[model samples]
Target: MSFIRKRRSLVLTSTLALSILFLSLIAVMVGLLYKEQKNAAFHGFTEIGAKLSAQAQVSSNLIASVAGAYENKQNPQAELVSSLQLQLNAMIDDDNLTNAYYMSTKQFEIDGQPNLITMIQSSLSSEGSNDNGTDYPLDDVFLDGYHRVMTGETLLTHAYSDDIGTWISYLAPIKDDQGNIVAMFGLDYDYDQVKRELSALLWGVIGIGMLAAAVAIGILFFIIRATVRPLGMLAVAAQEAAQGNLTISMPVTSSDEIGRAAASFNDMIHSLRQLTSSIKQTSDEVTVSSLNLKEFANQSSQATQEITIAIQTVASSAEAQFSSSQETQRAMTEMAIGIQRITESSAIVSDLALHTSERASEGEQALRDTVHQMNSIQTGVLHATDTMQELQLASGKVDDILTLITEVAGQTNLLALNASIEAARAGEHGKGFAVVAQEIRKLAERSRESSDEIRTILQAIKEKTAAASAVLEGSAEEARTGTELVQTTGSSIQSILASIKQVSDLVQDVSAACQQMSAGSEQIAATMVEQEQIAKRSSTNSHHVAAASEEQLASVEEVSGASEQLRVMASKLGEAVSRFVI
Candidate 1:
């Protein structure tokens, strides 16, 4: 087994198996034909023996008389003997079925079997070939048959070798008028001649059988080639499909099983093609949505950053205004103290006090006017501050929207990633889909990056705004102190001190209002930072709106399915993220 090569094919196997079977059938046929022919030759010998015995029986009287005449030294009828010889001569010819014939008288038994001596042989006839008469012992080679024939039974012998050649002999007994078996007639057929005939017949049969086997084997190969070649092609096509090449299709050439199978394969390829198309389309949609969401989030972030920067600028300006107001309040406090002492002196001197009172009255009116003017400035600053606070709050709201956009982008990215995984599982055929998924993922990442940059800028603005707000708080505290001093001065120096004090109060109020506005702006800016961060995050995964968007965002689940529920994206990042965030 180890020494032999083990290569096998359908054609080889089929041809080998059938060849063995056909050869075996032919062998059986030849064996049977040969056996039958041999049997037929032996049967012919028996028939000839019987015929000779019949003739002998019909001339029993002549045979008996001839034997009696030879025994008594008298001549039996020559014409009768000659006529019998002539009849026997005809059967002895080379072309005749029987090779030789003889009459033999049974004498004695050896080993319980009768032996014989040939009495009248057919060799003296013109066509005769054998001359062993009276001396040739017939029973040696034909023991079984001769013994049986002497007992009044006809018998045939298998082929045996004699002095002349191999022969099959048949022996029949001849009976006298008294029914006593006197002699036996023997007929012989040449075994060699029969064998030659059988050989010729066998050769003819073999020639035809071999030719038929050759034709059959050729046909077997042709059938296998026709059938198996198509099947092999189908196999190759199937392999391509297995490798994820759904583009391959088999051609149906017939209505046979192979053809039907090919048709089915083509159908399968078509279905797979459609399925891949759907998946690819879904991925493409997700990519577009993410990109759009990213862009929207980025814009919102940038706007928020700008607003935060503007608020920071306003806070810095307010800080400067508050500083100046505090300086003015300090000057007013010093002057107001001076006016109080002066008012004390005026009370002591009458005429001086009268003039002083006149000046004081004018000063009182001027102080009142100054104070009112300062109040108006304070009111204006307060409104400005309030407006700044509202703007910050609005910015925070805008940040919230940005956050939403970021989330949409991030989700779209995730969906694209999932689609890529599925494509990988599908193998080489899914290479195109995988590429789409990669593009989508890249787009999402870009969205996330943009959102991050904007969020950073917003954070920086928030920090600056907070710092400005701190400075404003210090300024506001100083303003409150200066305002208290202004009130005290107004009570003491009713005219002069009052006017200075009122002016100081007005300045202080404006400073305080500006400080409040600055603080509010800072808080608003901080809130905007938080909102922007949220928005950026939202934008980051917002692309894959399928799962999280729709339910989390709404219909982020379906993107649509293969749609099979393509939710992996339907918030599919919310209708391709509002079709470019228009």
Candidate 2:
């Protein structure tokens, strides 16, 4: 059953068994005492009867004279009976013999067998007996004593019962002048009085035994209750512990086993409480980590999407740049052909020289258009460079965030390590917690590794973006040089028109300037091609970075999920431990 009940039962059973054993022992001792007292009382009565019988021997002469008179058919004088009664009366004492008398035996026939008759008796009798001579019963014990007395032997009866009362009779033989046995003197003691005393003693012993049993029962009850009381408290404490209330304190009243067990129980509860508190703290940390990781994952995902869009824009810009470079090359080829035609006309006629001036004007206008296009290309390159710089800044910020994440992961790992150590210190009870700590440590390591990967990708993106910016700047400078060359070509064209009257000398110069403009256009096209290739590479790197970011984000999400699970597990553990009151 319940612990308290079992304890109480055990104690009660032990007490009862002991009490029964004690009572039985006391009963045996009392019975023996009563038997001894009974024997002593019987012995005392026998002694008193023998003493009175000896005292009656003093009247032996008178008793023999009376017997002689009675045997001759002569009535004994009243004075002899009176004298015998007076002497016997002197022997009679209070609380001793009940009767003392003398009797003379005579031969008679009974059923064809010889028998003895009492011819004379003392006049004295106990207050309860008849004074007149009366025949005594011929029982075996009485006859044996009487015969022994007739043979001059002193005898005591073995206590007999009759109509008058229970008694022990003692007999002493009366002798004649010739020393022959003629009569017996007897004394009877009241055995009934001894029986009453013994009965009283027996009752007293019974009363004492009953009192002892009662006292024993009371003492046993007190002892059992005192012993069981502590156990009851312990049982209550255990019940409270079972109900998850560890706050109970037991009183250590003694250095007994129960007290020691209570102390140990309290210690256990305290330890469990500490472990629970640690688990709760760890759970809170894990929850915070999960939230932070989730937020970081979302931010990283957004950053990657932004990077993807930026890369797509850069790719578009690079494609436009490639197409623009091709157009510039085509325009340069067309300008070279026009320059060849102008050179051919210059050798043909001076009258054709006006037409040559008009062609030169048109060529100057084309050169101005080329300058404007080059300026526009320079502006686009600068704008793309600025955009790339902004993307690089963003990547730098992401790197910083990753660094922070790595630091957090490291801190979390340290915390997990500390927790694991504490769990190890807690021994077997904390094995589950140690496993949880190990899992948390693993998650933290994974997080740190993921952060490292993200940092690496950001570093690559930063390098690629820087390279792309430098290329864009170089391309812008080349475009500016091309614009200046186109402006110089336009200026040379104006001067050639002013000197068209002496056009033949300036023809070679004009051809050389056209070739220079063509070379500059080719250089500009080469620069644009280089810028486009750089932009394409930058776009590819950005795409790689974006993909890596996505992967890192996924890893972060996994870490976050793991952290969340860890948090939940810790919470469950805490809740489980919380069932204890402590």
Candidate 3:
């Protein structure tokens, strides 16, 4: 295949491959990001649930402790219940609990008054059949626990939902001196808070993930266009040069991979130009040699025809010479001189062919050297392409790591949220824990942001690496085709050399025969002038043959010089291409 076509193929294939790789990286990053978001969401939900559960437990414990304090009769009725209720209400008000309440099964009065207890009873009755006349479910668990308190049974049921919210209701039975329950107390937590926090966190993470993805895609697109496009241009240029179109120039004008590739392409073009020029020069010389050979052959054919006519004349003379033998001998001697001249011309042709063969051998050696250098360049390009591929793979791995980091950040955020909820529920006692929760959440946010940055950077690296790989692959393929062309030229030179060698051997044999012919032609007086003329013609042909040989030698030298220059240029191109490492 022609170098140009191979180079174009390489360019197209490399471009497509790079594009695919870049897209794949983006897809992998996006997938990883999505997974991280999902993990974060789940983790956030779990943490939120656990925090809520912890807060609820702590609240429940506080309610039980306060209830125990109230039952101990540490002070008077109004003072203890009123102060205790106020404090318990304050606790619930300050935290995330659904409700906190304490009620007595006995006649508990406000402000140290008896009739007030009756009024309170009447109020409770008016509100509901359970807690006065209220429609809301009002259970006097203290009344139910009256007998259980003596049995030391404090009922704590599983969490449930009420008008207030989902809650874990704790029942701590308070007993009198008579071992009868007097009051019951508990608090209800706002269980929905966990779900609310989880929802909020989920949305936050999703928003960040979308933003990151958008940024990454944008960056990748920019990088691919900026970097890959130039590389493609360089590849095209290289292809053109390889095809013997040395005027091709790369459009990429940057200091990056594209720029380097373009420069290398230019260098390769220069080399190819020199190589082609040499080959053309050699071919021109060969053409001139062929013309010389054709002229020599025509001359020899004419001389042979003249000799044949002269022989006919001599034979006729010989038949007529029964009357005069001298005339027959004279004609015969002239014909022999003509034959000697023809033999000498043939000898000159043989010498020219020998010189041509030697020149061809030299050309063949130069072509072989050029092919070897091109092969080395091809090998270097292949290695460079492999290195670029490895870089792209490494970039992919970095993207994966970013995804993992993002996921962990999300989980950490969830944990912080849960801790926050727990601290809220803990009220004044949980204040220190709330600060820790806040810090953790901040750290998570930072981590998420960092992962996003990493993903963006990795995406850029992936794009650049992919582009580099594409350019390298294209260059390698072009070099391979170039090597093949060089090899082909080398083979052609060898063939020409072999043909020349045969011609040279024929010429040497003809030279020996011509000497014998000249010696045999010496005795005929009438043929003497003809013999000298043939020798002169032979000498002129030999001079022309020598001139052609000199031209062939000069052409061969030009080819060798061009081939050497090509080798140097290819080496320079390979060196320039190597600059993109890393």
Candidate 4:
């Protein structure tokens, strides 16, 4: 009953439910069978009563026909009445009837109503003693059967309960020799006796059913227990696992669903064991890694502080370098401008010297043409008076050419001297300028000496030509020498022009180098300015980075503490899982 209200063990509940159901079914079957058997027994008992009624009816007809007892109505026949009573008692005894009796078809008036009278009855009849004539009331069921039997029908009644006992009745017609139904005979059956026998049989069946049900329940209990035992073990293992004992493994005894469940449980336990082991290892690793990370954070913080200080120092140095570079750039720019002016001045002087040399060469060429004309004229005039006049004109032209060359050499020497002084100011940047200036000065000096020699030779030629034709031969020789001297002087002037050009070229190169150096110094100044700004900004940013590193170091310390706690938890988990038996 408690199992019915709440959950119980699987085997126990199942056995009880199945056993009860079987017993109830057997009870229902037995009840139905007993009902049918009791009904049929009642019917058989009624049939036996009918047969006895029929025999009593025949005996009555015999008495009526042979003894003429019933034919003589309203007349007493003692021997025949006794004989009929004795025969009815014999029918009652033979059939084990509650009573047997006969009733006349004739009605007798009693208490202002005509009623059928009991003609005869057995010793068992409770109708006031074995009666020869006694009034009897017929109820509906009895009345119907009585009328039917008087019409020569034999029948039985359904079982009914009276004051004495439960009973069924049989009715038959008694006929005389004239074939008229004179009386009807009835016999009552003991219906309760039939029910008693059936009740006994039903009790026997119920006893057997109870024993069989008990045996079946026992068999079912064993079967269910076998089926559920593994499940019970699985439940115990599950409880252990719930208690943090993951090491337990259920033993699998069968290949059924419960056994497979047990095997799966074992696999789960193994997986959990492996997972917990990994957690422990990982916690240890996390602890070590946290310590390392904390140390790294501290080192990084210190390095950040050092970097901040270093960046401040760099910023100061960069500012100083930037100021120096600016000064250098401005100074170089001024120097470049001065060098450029010097180069211009050198170019102008060289151009003027070159123009002077060209003019001297033109003058020398003009003198040669004039002298050749004179020689041609003189050859003819060697015997004439105008030859000396032509020779004197040629000598004058030669003297003019020599004076122009000397002046050109003087101007070139002055310009070269100026270039040498300017080159000295430019220092190493103008070394080429200095070497070219020295060469120009040497060429100019040599040109001036050549010009003086040419002037002396030309004066001698002029005087000798003035002595007339006697000295004409000597005059021609002197003119030829003067011509050679003029040619040599022209070569010297050309050399001076070339050396001046070289000086101009070298000055240009020095100017360009100075300009390049100026530009380079300016770029260096710009780079230094940018580097100074970057260093200042870097110093500021380094402070921020150092602050962040301090924060990071603090976070790393927290992580180290948390990792230590995690290691402790992992240790506890390992200890918990170690309790189960695998």
Candidate 5:
């Protein structure tokens, strides 16, 4: 069913059929050879039998005695029969003759009618005794041969079979000294021996035929395999080509039909490969173009989106600008009304500033007196801080005196301990000295205790002195701050007096500046009204631009979709082409 199997089956079937035919031809040839061999064996046996019959005729006397013995139903001379039988046995011993004998025809009466008795043979018995009256079968061929032999003819019998086995007999005539026919000498050639030789030759021919058939079958198997192998390869290549792999080509090994077919198949495959490659390249180009188009569409869409956003921002800014311009126009009208009211208030404020100038001059003189008192207090506080620093130094000197007194007491205690040790060494005589050393030790102890109390009292005085120095430094800093504040107050009062006089002059200038502000506000209002109209037009134009951008974005989206579809189609085409190996 499959291509390769079909091709193989075809080759095998042809080979098998050819083998059968070859075997048949061999069988027929062998049969013919066997027949020819059998015929040759038969002819050779007939010739041999004829030759032996001629040899047997050398003893015509012995053949006559045996024949006469059979005719008279009497035993022949044993010596003469034995000598002839020995000669016949010797002739048969060297060849495939079953018996060498004499045969004769006799006439006898049976049932009062004359019947010719034929095929009467006188042979040596199996025991090598002379037997002269052994009768053979009355075969028609033997009877015919007997008639010929009686007429002084030598005859060779056709092959025939009886109980003694199939044979061809050679019959030769015997004559008296007168040379007339009397009896026949015969040699029986074994037909079975010829058959055995033929059978051996037939077996030899059969062996040779079988060997030839085996060799032919072996050669044919290789030849058929070689013939159909390319066909199988081509079938497989075709199947692959059908599956879109067009890369296979067949090898052409000869100039025969199969080779030519293989060359053609290779050419077809090459053409298919080229076509598939071209298709794949075209598909790739289409895919690339689609991708580029899609990218462009995407860029266009993004640009439109950006443009729409920009326009929307511009429209919003324009709307806000327009609202700000309307508010500015309203603010300008209120500013004009306030400027007129301020012009009337300016004359009244000028008289009040003149009156305040005189009161500020009086306040400046009182602040100067207070600044002088604060400076005096600051000087006194600086002096008290100096005095407290001197007291802290005196307390440090007292602490140093107390340290000297404590050192002197420690020296006295050491001297008293040394004196007490010396007095103890003196024993009863140094008892007074010991009592005096003890009193000195008590005095040194009291002196050390007094010095410790004085150091404590000096430490308390140093603490109080440090506290007093801190309080004086703080009081001095406060006094300096108060002096500076009073001086600043005096300076401020003087500045206020000068400012009151300047305010009187400024009040008059304010009335003139308000008039100028009102005229400028009116001009600004007119300009703002024009700007507001322009902003409103700008907002409307921005809205139009944004709407156009939105429409352009939608168009770009459609183009992007078309590009995407084209890309998809190209990709699918490329994928389809890519399935082929080439």
Candidate 6:
């Protein structure tokens, strides 16, 4: 990379490192702070737990005092056990308590199976009583303070789980009037709430720590940029120097590392400027010396009349060479023009192809639209077919209804005829009844013919609709095929347009190269004419100054040979330069 690019990249990397380091420091500090806060919170929670345990002891003592007032001969309800249970339940009702239960000691007889009577109040519904005829294990809270309860000291034991592990209970003793252990009371509190609060607090602290880290990173970026600003300025100045603008310089006011770099840049530019000036003067002198040598060589050649006479053929040969060069130049010019024409034609062809592609695209779009419309038409046709099927069913229903009406009409007519016959048996009223029956019979016959004609018309409609649906399906399929063809044509046309665009681009490049060649050949022709004039002038000078043609003639031959060698070298150099196409 260039110096400026490399320097900028280094500065950016340094800034990133500093920012990351600062963020890491912030993380460490925040972590320590959070750890201390978490410890303090846990210590406070432990103290609260101790206080709650102590309070449970006080409530248990009060319950035991109340229970001791009853006589042993009384029933369980009459002995005030219920009241003590109620009081214990009220204490457990506190938000911090989980469960409270009462267990009677005298309720079991065996040593392994300690007598236990479990009592619960309504508020202590989550506490359940298990079989009291079971041995108390070493880990049991009730076993730890068995002596304390026996002594009636109002014992408080640490919290622990029972056999089923439903709740963590703090068990305290209940006593009777004789200062003997009667029962143990307990209060269970949930632990999940405490954990949840701690987790929320941890997340809050982490969120604040992340926010602080982000702020610190932003500040670090600014600080790093301030530190590297002077270096950036020196870097741009150095770039200008490298591009040959040696007068470029950077200001140096500070005594920091960046300031020192700027000072060195100024010193480097000064030295380069001096060196470039010396080199330019030396090159100019060498160019003048080479031209002088060429003139002297022409002069030496002209000193020999024979050589001059032989080279008079050069003017003629040069004319022929010039003519050949002009012809070659003309051919190149024509080729360049032809290539330009071809490029233009290709561009036009590409444009026409693009137009065709666009038209094909439009056709494809139209086909797509037609396909969509055909799909909609097909949907409508299917709906129509459904409607026609429904109509045909309705038509059948109508025919059945007509047949029923005709049957009912016939039945009424038959009933009327029977009534008329009965009337004719009565003789006088029979004539009017007979006429009515005859009219109903004629009307039934006409209705039957009309229903048959309606059925025929419905059958014709069904056939015509079926034929129309088949034609619609065939048309829809043809539309889909046409859409695919149009899309394929559009794709093929687009590919052709792309190929033509590439050809046009290559033709343009060829034309540009040919134009450059024509320009260079014109410059060479002009330079050759200038050299021919200089040769004739040197020949005239040589004729005027010659004191001895023999010595000058020898010099002329030597110079001519040198000039020929120089021309050969120039030709080789031209060939070497021509190897590059552009």
* Top lDDT prediction, candidate number: 5
lDDT of 4: 0.55
- Clashing residue pair totals per candidate (backbone < 3 A): 56, 6, 11, 0, 0, 6
For lDDT, candidate 4 versus 6, the one ahead is 4
The C-alpha stretches of model 6 lying farther than 4 A from their native spots are 1-200, 203-207, 304-582
Residue-level lDDT of model 5, residues 230-250, one tens digit each, is 645655665565566667777
lDDT (C-alpha) at residue 93 in model 4: 38
Computed on alpha carbons, the lDDT of every model, listed in order, comes to: 0.50, 0.58, 0.48, 0.55, 0.60, 0.46
Each prediction's RMSD over C-alphas, in Å, is: 44.6, 44.8, 13.8, 69.7, 63.8, 34.4
Per-residue error at 125 for model 1, in Å? 6.4
Q: How do all models score by TM-score?
A: 0.48, 0.44, 0.50, 0.44, 0.41, 0.33
Sort by lDDT, top down from the best: 5, 2, 4, 1, 3, 6
The ten-residue window of minimal lDDT in model 4 covers: 469-478
lDDT of 2 at 503: 36
Q: Which tens-of-lDDT digit does each residue in 104-193 have in candidate 6?
A: 454444656544444434345544543222333434555555545556544334545565443334444554445555556555555455
Worst 10 residues of 2 by lDDT: 342-351
Model 1 earns a TM-score of 0.48
Instruction: Quote model 2's TM-score.
Output: 0.44
Indicate the residue-level lDDT of 369 in model 5: 54
Candidate 3 lDDT by residue in tens digits, 162-185: 454665444454444554544444
Candidate 5 TM-score to native: 0.41
lDDT (Cα) of model 2: 0.58
Worst 10 residues of 1 by lDDT: 552-561
